[model samples]
Target: MSTLSGAPAPPRIPEAVHRRRWAILAVLMFGLLIVVLDNSILNVAVKTIASPEPTGIGATQSELEWAMNSYTLVFAGLLFTAGLFGDRIGRKKVLVFGVAVFGVGSALAAFSGSPGELIAYRAVMGFGGAFVMPATLAVVMDVFERHEQPRAIGIWAGSVGVGMAIGPITGGLLIEHFWWGSIFLINVPVVVVALIAMALLLPDSRDPNPGRMDPLGVMLSIIGLILLVYGIIRGGELANFSAPSVLLPMVGGLVVLVCFVLHEWRTDHPAIDITYFKRPAFAAAVTAIALVFFALTGVTFFSAFYLQSVRGYDALEAGLLILPLAVAQMVVALRARLIVDRFGARSVCTVGMLLVAMVLAAFVMFDVSTPLWVIELVLLMQGVAMALITPPVTVSVMQSLPREKAGSGSAVSNTFRQVGGALGIAVLGSLLSTQYRGAIEGHLSVVPSGARQAAGESIEATLAAAERLGPAGKALIGPANEAFLHAMHLTALVSTGVALIGALVVAVFLPDGDPEPERESAEGAPGRALPVSGR
Candidate 1:
């Protein structure tokens, strides 16, 4: 039944097969959504976990940071290699395996007794996620027709918005009524349902002509991504000009990544198909996508904390406050196919990126003294921009590739986005922390020397205590809060710059046309024809 031969008879599309494909896509989407949502939910819970425990074991600031980073670090590191593996073996088999591993890891995270245990389990979950994410998109491409692809992709993209929307609200409610662990435990039931659906619906498909796995290339990618992310997060946290520990990994990671580029250039069939960059459309779309996530992920990570830490909202309240961003993203995603078909990727993405930048700039203006509605309005504007941007960008990338290589093509696109997100969190997060300290130090300088020492010694603790501070202490805290808000504003400004870069990149690079088909139609007709685009 190979579709490789140009004259191979057109395989009849059985009705049952089409039904099964749709069902499988739905199940996979559910599973993938749960994984995406978990990444964001923890942002709202960080402050809640850090309180009362001076040792910061269950919930310290460092522990909270690790809880989030541990997952992302592993996810980005393994994505490229894992995508190749899934294509070589079988997408369904790989996905089922990933879901099981993810479920077990989630359970382990929920029951983790210490910060170390939680970090370890989160890493395990990330490993499973690596396989799960690539396989889901690969299978979707395989099962759907080219005409059906955009609509399906639009739906797929919307899952992220759905996941993003649900994470905060559901996570918030669970934390409010239950313990922090409940957030992790919540994945189990959802995963179980998804597993059942996948088993029943997904087809078994493997690469018709697979290549050998590239071990050295895999190692280079993993090491390069890890060190790069480590340097950024560390630099953001410490922001020290003279620290060897921070500088070493950061510099070392960049060196390794440079070596990786050289290695890929020389290898036959490199683990990552770096040659995709040769296509202007592919290069431009990828750059725009990375920039897109750079802005949104930073906002998602920081704003969640801003609501919880600065505004003193509980988990649910913080989640509810960020809901607009998610809701707007969802509505935009569902309709993105129609929008892209009419306007082209360049126009849609350009407008979207510009809007996102504007919203981010508006956010930078917020202060402790600023009203809450203004923050919400800015967020709403950003939400609208993201809604338009993400779907078309993804559709553009997929359409630019040949169908036979759809799995790897989508994987490369996804890997870049994840890498950008990891960097955004690291870079922007560091900026916020650095600015926060500077603002805190500057404002506290106006305080008497004795009080300044206390503020300097334990900012997190003092901030916690300041909440209970009476009017006089509250007076002192007013400046501290303003400093914290100011730091966040600087972060917003950084995101605005990042988004602006993405808009220009998309405008310059992504091709203008009806989103080109990833699965190109067979050339000629009847007996004299090319094979169906996918093997």
Candidate 2:
């Protein structure tokens, strides 16, 4: 799938050798696993390392905020610009450069002297991740023709699910015996192997006419995304009605985003090429993917906290509790392409979203006293729902576009997902924080110290303090625990409602596969676009 200018068609590797295509796909999947794992590996380590060497020098709530958001904010901001650059240059070359940059960033993060240093390095790592992610998908589209693409992407997507599933467990194990920085160091060898494989297997690919890169558009995008993410993450920390810290970033980010849209409309070589949104299928597919991450990220964020904080589970035990979700996700991921091949993406995605909604609602009954089986069932259901949805929707978005624009198209789709993940954690986390704080304040109103805030800004603090409390304090903590769980229940309910809305949107706007004539010949099959056949 390399798109060299005036370059002759590459000699196809013989299928007898198992084809170079699958090998190339393996290299890309390595890249996908690295990027996806990086997103969640720190989840289990955050609680362990929030405190600095002096015990609490750099362990404030804001510091914890930087530790998590720094990576994602930069990753989302740079995604589109990196894709545009990769398409302009060669995707393979860009990926190599990205690997080198990420390696250096990882080393710095591993050896970081302070929390601030780690945040800076994390941002650098994210910049590199932006390049690797889009390039991987673009190469897949280039190497595998439309028909073979489903199977190829299915394998890649499944690996991603497995990597994400393992990330928390790996982090938990490493943190138990090692330091927080071990998570970053572990990426080094993986990157080295990935870089070598990529160099040997991936063919060069780039847009035929990439045109000029829009500097204005790039700046607008970065600033807008950063501000939006920061505001969302810092929600409720500002003044009640209209605080500048909150209002400025949220409103200003929106303005900058609108300006970016206008800039893309006017510019000849827009970074994102906003015209893609005109296609209903593309829009629906991206939305579905984003919505999935929105729910999944929120669940992961809160569930880890609930397991460790309320249930008093160690990191290993918490990770083990989450194993069912990952296992179910992998099982269902293997079947997605088969289901889509038989039924089509439209039906699979809609049903998948509804299933997620039902699963989330089922968890609303969870409490400090809820049985473990109840939690396991919810996790399993969510895993299966995600597994069924992610691959087909991603495949549809990539296949709908011409091969040349695959890099940009994949980046656009991924951007939605990253943004959704950030928003979900920020919004839902804020809701829980606000509710927890109010609950503690109300329950401890009689304390002579005027109800000092909980240590470490965690809901778990009240529950843990219960052990040392007098009879009166013990009574107070019981109400606080109830409030915290109540807030979590509300967050889950809101997420379910949003997911259902996304499902309805997909059903209304997205059409079934009706392969157009130009696409049919290019795809080299008739009615292959129709409802998928049997597995």
Location of the lowest summed lDDT over 10 successive residues in candidate 2: 526-535
Error of 1 at 511 (Å): 0.6
| Per-residue lDDT of candidate 1, residues 317-376 (tens digit) | 888888887788788889987887788778888999999899988877775556878877
Q: Candidate 1 versus the native: TM-score?
A: 0.90
Which runs of model 1 end up more than 4 angstroms from their true locations? 1-8, 12-15, 53-58, 369-372, 442-460, 467-473, 515-535
Estimate TM-scores for all models: 0.90, 0.88
Off by over 4 Å in 2: 1-18, 51-62, 236-241, 445-451, 454-456, 461-480, 514-535
Q: Taking the tens digit of each residue's C-alpha lDDT, what string does model 2 give over 1-535?
A: 3333544433332232235777777778887787767656776666665544632224444566566778788888888778877777878888888887888888888877788888899889988888888888887777675677778777877887688688878877877777778888988999999988877667776776567778999899889887887776666333132567877898898899999999999988788767677777788889888887787677677777677766667777777777788788777887788888788778888888999899878768888888999888888888888888888878878877766677888888888899888777777677667666665666665444533464314565554445445665667556766777777788889888878987897677766673222133233432122111111
What are the RMSDs of all candidates, in order? 3.8, 5.3
Q: Which candidate gets the maximum lDDT versus the true structure?
A: 1
